[model samples]
Target: MEKIISHAISERVEFVLIAGDIYDKEDQSIKAQVQFYKEMKRLEEARIDVFLIHGNHDFLEQERDRLELPKNVHTFSSDVSCVPWQSPTGTKIHFYGFSYDKRHIRENRLGDYRKHGDADFHIALLHGSEETKASEHDVYAPFGLKEMKQKGFDYWALGHIHKREILSSQPGIYYPGNIQGRSKKETGAKGGTIVELSEMGATFSFFETAPVMWEKKQIVLEGKADRTEIYRATDELFQTYRDTLCSYVIDLEIVTEQASKFDADEWLQLFEEMRTESPFVWINTLRFIEKNQAVSDKWYQGQFLADELDASLAELMEDETFF
Candidate 1:
């Protein structure tokens, strides 16, 4: 976050749009408040405006004594609200958004986003998941892509289901993902989008702010391979990424015919011995993948079991009695 603030200052951005999830906890600690305030204060001093909303992780609490932020920082209330701003170049922008008052919000608030005040640009900040029958994300503030398109907004800045997705390009709908990958599931470059808008159209570019990245790599050992061959192959893979600028937490998968015979812990211990060789890379997880397992009867059995489980889940989800 410090890096991001510094980048924004260096770039001299007119404003910063933080969609949601600024804090991990609903009850924001004094330390978190102090750190965030200091960053926003810098923006205030630079004559830059900030617009932000609260996500499910850090919903609003009426009774809590909220820290007063700088006047330049504008926060959306629980209800859908619109705030207009005129840039230094006299471009009128109307920002529409709402904050989460509770952890679970099943309401579909996409329709609530309406262009207001005849502004040059209409941008909506939403922190929610797209509505789907089945999804890895929690279905909070559920919305459909079609519904979003119908709203007629100039741009949509979405959040919650991180893994930066570009849902649409015509009106510039995007989820910039989280600035940092906190888990193995989120493995890639993490950053925010820099948008330039005018009456003619809009242009978007992504800026990288993450100092550390998470990556997954695979090493294939053809046929029967001994410990020496495995170590050599792994070393070769690490060598490829030795000159990279950033540090990485790597999930390394070893694929071989004798995968079942090799132990993950053993290989991890061996790699740890060579840790000094590549300081930029750290092995987060070591998995043994059997190359020929897909053709085996056990694989077929596993697939059948998975299908059955999915079918059961679908049926359960459809049952009105459970609801």
Candidate 2:
């Protein structure tokens, strides 16, 4: 947030838009609210406008006590509405969005968003997932891609998905993604998009704001390679990140046909030893995968004892007398 505020001030952006999920939890702590307020206050002092909405994670609760935001901040209400703002260069812009009133919003609200007014640019903010049964994410305000494209908004600033993606380029539908990664699974350069819009179309670039990044790298070894060779490759991998400015929490996956030769305890000790060498890199996890097999025979014997016991139990049950 500090980086974002600094960037906004430095770039002299007319306004800032936070799609949703400002708070991690619905019942946000006072400390978080105070911290956020301080950041918002900084933007307010710089005379930058902030427009934000609530997502499922931080859905609005009318009964709950809420901290009053700064004067510069404009929050969207439960009902879909369009707020107009004149850009620094005198380009009329209309921002259309709505805040989540409850945790679950099963209804598709995309139809509610319609480009209106004589504004030069129309930007819509939506915190929802693409309507698909295969999606692992919770379906809230589900929308179809075709439905969104047909809306004819100049740009769609989306939220809810932690991974940054440009669903469409022509109309500039984007998911800036979460600025900070909360888990190891959410990897890559985590940040928001700086969109440059015009009467022609929209062009945007992603900026890295995450102080610490989560990354996963896989090291593939030949069947003939020994432990010494494997360790050397791992060391080489860490050396590549020596010039990284921000700290990284990396998960390493070692793939080899000679999985039996690799020892977890030795790798764990090696990780601990190398962790102190670089202040910027911390190896959070180490996993081994067999070359062509799903699970290595040695992995089951050494790591997954529960699976082995289950197999043993199944064998005993074949005797008929073994309950």
Candidate 3:
């Protein structure tokens, strides 16, 4: 949420639209709720209006009724509503949205929604999955891009999915994915989408403001095994970040079959010393494994034992306290 707000500030966006699922749960702690309100207040102070809707996680209930929000924050209830605002670029925009009353809404909510007729630009904010065989998401509240386009919406801002995607080419249908990745599975660059509207048409831009960045790097440790090769691989990985001035939560996976006298403990110690030299770089997860092929009949029990020792060392390198 902070990243979204910061990006909006930097880009000087007219207003921010949160389709749904603002909070992970309705019963979140008071501290979290308060902090959320504070950020909303900050956006409100900046004259930025926020249009929000309730998703499965943050379903509207009596508990949410008690909490107060800033005037700039407009939340849709059971009834569909349209809020009109003028952008700094002098484009008149109309935002139409509604929240799901229940966790599983089978019906197509967009069908009941009234269109903003004759508006310069009309945006429909919804939190549901598009009907597609390839989609692994629930069929609940299903709607299609063609259906949305036929309904006369200029742009459809969708949520509920954690991966950013542009669904339609003509009418400009988009899913902003998620504000931040909650786990490693939702790794890589996760962020929101920015929309620009005008009398001619609408254009879309992606803004990545995720607080925690996730990056996966594969380091090949093949051929002659030596300390120099390991050091060189680390340097290469670090050099990849020269273009993007951003700190990364990196998961380094080293694939090799070569074995040397240096044990896992020694390798970890060297990495720790290198980390001390450059505290800014972080190695969240490290996986080192030996690449093996088919076992030949000529391989004896002694060779098997040696291979087992190499695997053990690789596993030990994963532990931070191995040194």
Candidate 4:
């Protein structure tokens, strides 16, 4: 916490903007809440204003309203509100933000906010889906890149999509991703964005500040996989991390449809050997699925037996009903 504050202080960032989903949940533990407020306070003491909006996960409600926040921290209301910040460098930035009133908000919020022409740089900070087909997010808060760009905002900082991405090039649209990857699905180096705005234009930079990192590596075993094939794949994956120079937790997925001739014991032995070789790598999860080419004669034979059994059982049950 101190390190991040120190870094922000050194960077001399004008103000910090958290687009949305600031908390994993509104019911976060007291310890978590305290720590969050502590960091906000530290930033406030440093004379940096922090603006945040509620995400789908942390919708604004009576429960959230009860928590006490420092004066330096400001949250957006249900209605669209614009907050302006002036950097010591004499550059003015206007931030328009809003939080989801409920967990599911199916309305176009962009149309509500009046477009600002006075500010040097206009930023729209939101926690919603920009892609129409982003099924992973709430379908209600849908907006397109072109529409947002046409709205006349200089930049858009978006959230709710866990994957970090710059959605559009002509006009800036960024999903900084989540600060901390809560689960295996939210993998890779997760963090926020640092925007630098000036009279000339705006440049955006990404900063990874999460304590834990999530990475996924897919290994495919081609045709007729064996113990040696598994060992080779494991070795290749471990070798890739040799230059990382830090302890890493890796989630590996081995995908192939080819059925291996190796027995379960042999596979287990290979996995044990790989674990012994790479102590730094923690193989927390492993999934195995049979990738058989097509319906085999053996499978047909088993199906025939199953059909026969089903017929016999039906006949037996039909003849002898329980009184």
The C-alpha RMSD of each candidate to the native structure, in angstroms, is 4.7, 8.8, 9.1, 11.0
**TM-scores of all candidate predictions against the true structure:** 0.87, 0.85, 0.76, 0.75
lDDT of 1 by residue, 262-287 (tens): 88998788777766543467888999
State how far residue 302 of model 3 sits from its true place (Å): 38
- TM-score for candidate 3, please give it: 0.76
Q: Give per-residue CA lDDT, model 2, range 179-290, as digits (tens).
A: 9888886788987678888667778887889988999888888766787888799889888888887889888888887676678667878777777443578878887777
lDDT of 2: 0.83
lDDT of 3 by residue, 1-323 (tens): 77778778777778888878888866767777788898888898888988888887676775454458899888988667888877777777788888877776656777776776466778888888777553333444678767788987777888777778888745768887776776555677777777876545557788777756777777767675577887788877776665564556667766666643446565656655655332244667776655553135325548658776765565444321121
Runs in model 1 deviating more than 4 A are 134-138, 276-279, 294-323
Which structure is stronger by lDDT: 1 or 2? 2
Question: Which one is best on TM-score?
Answer: 1
Q: What's the CA error at residue 176 for candidate 1, in Å?
A: 0.4
lDDT of 4 at 303: 59
TM-score of 2: 0.85
Clashing pairs in 3: none
Scored by lDDT, the top model is 2
Candidate 3 Cα outliers beyond 4 Å, as residue runs: 84-92, 134-140, 242-245, 258-273, 276-279, 292-323
What alpha-carbon RMSD in Å does predicted model 3 have with respect to the real structure?
A: 9.1
